[model samples]
Target: MTTYSEEMEKLGQVTIFDLLPPSPSNAFSIGDSVRVVITVESDSESYHYLEAYHPIVLKKRGEIIEIQGNQQYLVNFAGELHVMKEHEISF
Candidate 1:
């Protein structure tokens, strides 16, 4: 039987042990409360502030989207969902 770790490795995905924890290693996890440190500028044509320094709950971790290498996290605020980079939030 293929173990979870082996399956993840075969798919070219890093297993938990392969990652170095961020500075505040114990930072935040799914369901943890977080806050926006800066407003996220929309990537679309609409010129609007996505969010400010508002309290939000960590929802889920998203896949790496670009070559710049920052990972995105799903957060919920005011019953709305938004994606923000790790550096853009505070726990």
Candidate 2:
């Protein structure tokens, strides 16, 4: 596992580890609240909160498609892939 500071460095400028205690990391335990922001960097910065925990795989290039039911989103991240649930960010 990468430390919060180390991951921040890897992400370069797309994210920040701030506004919350860096204990739980990206995985949110029950009753845990956290503040996270992912900036995809386009015309402007995109900021939002990431739900505590639920497995998420991040990759530079991935496939995105919408499924009808059961598995709603099928994502191919890196050479390996997995199923993931939807997530939202708080302002």
Candidate 3:
């Protein structure tokens, strides 16, 4: 099986590896505009690809968490709140 560490290593290495946790703050915030970027570790058919998929952060958490921790944010998508990752958004 692909280990969780292995998966995180691939997912975290793409810039976020250096920015997570106490060293630096997350790149986004509530009411901030963000676009979904194509990533190697992401599914190509994700909702982020749609032109109208742009979203605004509704809530944010885990700024002081570790790099590999479950830091996440809530975004306004299709009138619903969805949890999103730091890498899943682009400023």
Best by the TM-score measure: 3
Give the Cα lDDT of each candidate. 0.52, 0.35, 0.52
By TM-score rank, best first, the candidates go: 3, 1, 2
Candidate 2, 1-91: lDDT as tens digits: 8899778777874544464445423322222222222444521222322113322332133344333233233444444343333342111
- TM-score of each candidate? 0.40, 0.26, 0.40
33 Cα displacement, candidate 2 (Å) = 27
lDDT of 1 by residue, 1-91 (tens): 9999788799999767579765443345667666655533423221123322323332332332222233466666656666767766676
Off by over 4 Å in 3: 1-23, 39-42, 45-71
Task: Give the clash count for each candidate.
Answer: 0, 4, 0
Off by over 4 Å in 1: 1-26, 39-48, 51-70
* Candidate 3: residue 87 lDDT (0-100): 70
Model 1 clashing-pair count: 0
